[model samples]
Target: MFGGSDIKIDVKKPVYELIVEHILTNYNFLHKQVSHHVDVEYSAVLTGLALGDGRIHSAFKRARISDENAGEIAKKLMDTNIVRLLKSRKQFTSWVDDERVSDKLLFTTPFMRFWFAFVAPIFKGIKEGNYDEFNQRYENKIAEFREAVFKELSNELVKISFAEEKVVETGAYWDREVELDIFAKTASKKVIVGTCRYTNSKLKKSEIAKLEELANRAKIKADVFVIVAKRGFSSELKSLKSEDIRLFTLKSFKSLL
Candidate 1:
């Protein structure tokens, strides 16, 4: 919707074109909503956040800036409500002590993330009325992009699903040796480890085994396992859902609605 009224959808227009016309091209529209403090340094940092997988260290590296500069910029961004940091989950053991793990820097809103990832990176060509570059890059990784967003949403859904458990803390978890899409703890100190798969096919029983293996490697004694998928689950996997396991599909998100 634009200007407090619904804009008619053009069925034949490409989604990107629609986005550019309705959002990107309208300078005044964005000027009214987004921060006006964006400078070259801020743009670079945003590009880094978009491409660096939200890792502070990686963002600095990807943006070709020093850690000190990036750290300063990140704090300012946080203060301005542009981005926020998610601290790395602390672990008791030192199984992968040699490897370094950094806290993640996330955009406060999806719109900012989308802008940096797709538009800002290729703004020169876009300004010249050439969208080939943007279209090519977007098409290649659109599924992966959507899945990343879905994983974040799944975190909220998981929190909502376990009403009795009362999740105390939840977020993405990564160690030198292992990574999980969903790593949460309940008020009762029960660990919940899970995965989110956005794919065309049904999630199989093997996916459960993989999550368990990762939890084992991470030394987490998971009391409940979760699987959120786009295309739902296989019949075999569906039949296995019990107190210990939970399965959720796109339709499961209706609960959030």
Candidate 2:
């Protein structure tokens, strides 16, 4: 899609191979330099794990590569703009005071995460042109795959919802104590927090409770709350009769565009 033809998907090439080609095209460091390395296969394994797990330790373990090799692969990925680290949103809290926090690793885009999470791991089948097997595997796990994309959309909605205010911050919040799926603040200092449920069942009031709990543990009060749901809200949640809350379905999110 980059130039409409050269980088776009077609029926001829399998999706797994397409993503590999895309990465190989963009990351010249990975393409030109890493490919020349004696441990190229090892590097590719680490790259796939990094994209799939979003954890450095898990990536190393999955690849069964030494820490030294994993570190080199990570440096290449970072240098080539394929992946980046996300620092934990929890700061200046009880947990912050007690222990050191680690950053979460994230892909630069939704497609990269999707490709790595499901496609890249089973590359042999893809190379063998086993489209049926890849399709079945992808179909079975796509709902889980889209959660990351949905979370990204939910973050976008927070900014859209607060258009009147100067949004100072917006991102996921996590500490040893709790994790707020959507967190933000306005220039007026309004605290907004939320969560997303990308399942068939309706979102419930307990979700709000969870956000409140996370806020309490992190010692912050929210001036507004939002919910992004795929199915919709429960009757109890819809009838909550509260003014501080806003709800968004997948359909409603389109309007924000």
Give me the candidate number with maximum lDDT.
1
Per-residue CA lDDT of model 1 for 51-136, tens digit only, reads 55688887778768787677687788888776788865545332446666787888777667776777777777866667788889
Best of the candidates, TM-score? 1
Q: Name the 10 consecutive residues with the lowest summed lDDT in model 1.
A: 1-10
lDDT of 2 at 62: 71
Candidate 2, lDDT over the whole model: 0.66
Per-prediction tally of clashes = 0, 1
11-53: candidate 2 lDDT, tens digit per residue:
4887556654664334443234334432345444545443453
List lDDT for all candidates, in order. Answer: 0.78, 0.66
lDDT of 1 at 196: 93
Candidate 1 vs. truth: CA RMSD? Answer: 3.6
